[model samples]
Target: DQQVKQNSPSLSVQEGRISILNCDYTNSMFDYFLWYKKYPAEGPTFLISISSIKDKNEDGRFTVFLNKSAKHLSLHIVPSQPGDSAVYFCAASRGGGGSQGNLIFGKGTKLSVKP
Candidate 1:
């Protein structure tokens, strides 16, 4: 049973455009979140993260927002570049209460930024 779901499997955007990726979760107990970007032959790289205590987090061209009431989250990339093309995965975990913080991941949405 998948706890996280990325509704769209792919997204295409032109260079310098904005790319948005979405994800939904079944569990309401998840407290921590993360996003990872993966290239074809490389491992997923850490991108950005947010905690349930905060509604949003931003770094450079990447932004992540969490909607606790909806059990949903989204990643936004502005000024998209060709090098930004990758599979983006949304992940979450329970942060406290003696938990080890195991992350649940979405299938990922492949983003293609065309130049």
Candidate 2:
């Protein structure tokens, strides 16, 4: 069963535009959330993250919003650049002391930033 899901398989955006990616989860135990960007034939690299306690978090052009009530989250990238085009994955982990923090990942959303 998929604990996390990305309903949109792909998203297309113009360079210098905003790219919004969405994710949903059924497990309430997830306390920590993260977004990862992946390139072809490579491992996913950490992008952004938000704790359940925060409604929103931002860094530079990347922003992550968490709505615990709805078990939903989204990633927003402002002024999306061509280099930003990649597959984005939504991941969650149950955080606690001594926890390995295994991440449960969504299928992923392929983002295309057109110039």
Candidate 3:
């Protein structure tokens, strides 16, 4: 079973518009949530994170909101640009303070921006 799921495989948006991506999880034990953005042939880079204790986290043009009760999360990008096009992955981990932070990731959502 997929612990994390990104139902939409792809999304397209115009430049300067807002882009939203959704994610869901099945595991209730997961305590830490993270979002990563990746380009082709390269590893994912950490974008933002939110602990189960909080509901929202933001960074500049990117914002992530989590609903622990619903086991769902979302990422929003404002004024989307062509450079923002990439695969976004939602990840979750059990927060026991482990080494390297092992994560279970969703299949990934590819975002396309038209300039």
Local accuracy by lDDT, each model = 0.94, 0.96, 0.94
- Residue pairs whose backbone atoms clash in candidate 3: none
TM-score of candidate 1 relative to the true fold: 0.94
lDDT of 3 at 101: 60
Each model's RMSD to truth, in Å?
1.4, 1.4, 1.7
Q: Which ten-residue region of model 3 has the weakest summed lDDT? A: 93-102
Across 11-73, the per-residue lDDT of candidate 3 in tens digits comes to: 999999999999999989888999999999999999999999999999999999999999999
Model 1: CA > 4 A from native: 96-100
lDDT order of candidates, top first: 2, 3, 1
Give the range where candidate 1 is weakest over 10 consecutive residues by summed lDDT. Answer: 95-104
In candidate 2, stretches whose alpha carbon ends up further than 4 angstroms from where it belongs are: 97-100
lDDT of 1 by residue, 1-115 (tens): 8999999999999999999999999888899999999999999999999989999999999999999999999999999999999999999998665554788899999999999
Best by lDDT: 2
